[model samples]
Target: MEIREIFAHNLRALRKTKGLSQEELAHEAGLDRTYISSLERQIYGASIDVVDRIAKGLAVEAADLLRCPEAEATK
Candidate 1:
């Protein structure tokens, strides 16, 4: 899968795991709700700085967000 898609999947999974809604995650990440929604839908590509902000909001390492379990296992 594409990196953006992987990131979107991971972001949604993590956000749900943390029991946070898109609005709540956006608020915590200092981003707009629609932007967060777009990111989760793989409609937006985030910069490294934005990735860091998202990781901080999810309370996870930036690397964790980029790690795709299935892909990583193959590598």
Candidate 2:
């Protein structure tokens, strides 16, 4: 899958795992809720700064948001 898809998938999964709604995550990340929704839907690409902000919101490493789910399944 493409990197955008990977990021979207991981972002959604991590957000759910943390029991956070899109709005909640967006608030924590200091972003708009629609922007967070767009990212989760793969409608927009996140910049390095946005990724860092999101990672901080999720309390995870930025790399975690970019990890390929298929690769993880093989591990």
Candidate 3:
């Protein structure tokens, strides 16, 4: 998979593990629910600023949001 796809898949996995819905995660990430859904579906590449926001909202380090073969979020 592409780096973006890995990141998106990992993001969705993390959110589910936290027992949060797309709406809840988006709210926490200061984003729109559709946006999160789109991201998880790998419809777009998230910017660094948005990734930072998502990391903070998820209470995780920014590095934790990156995917492997890149930064190391996804396996």
Instruction: State the C-alpha lDDT per candidate.
Output: 0.92, 0.95, 0.82
How much RMSD separates candidate 2 from the native structure?
0.5
**Per-prediction backbone clash count:** 0, 0, 0
User: Over the stretch 1-75, how does candidate 2's per-residue lDDT look in tens digits?
Assistant: 999999999999999999999999999999999999999889988999999999999999999999899999999
**Candidate 2 colliding pairs, count:** 0
TM-score per candidate, chains pooled: 0.91, 0.97, 0.84
| Every model: Cα RMSD to truth | 1.7, 0.5, 3.0
Alpha carbon lDDT of residue 15, candidate 2?
98
What is the C-alpha lDDT profile of model 3 across 1-75, one tens digit per residue? 687877797788778878889898889988999999899988989998988988877888777767554454354
Determine which window of 10 residues in candidate 3 has minimal summed lDDT: 66-75
Output the better candidate (1/3) by TM-score. 1
Task: Provide the lowest-lDDT 10-residue window in model 2.
Answer: 36-45
State the number of backbone clashes in model 1: 0
lDDT of 1 by residue, 1-75 (tens): 889989998999999999999999999999999999999888878998999999999999999999886877799
Error of 1 at 50 (Å): 0.7
Which residue pairs clash within candidate 3?
Answer: none
Query: Model 2's lDDT to the true fold?
Result: 0.95
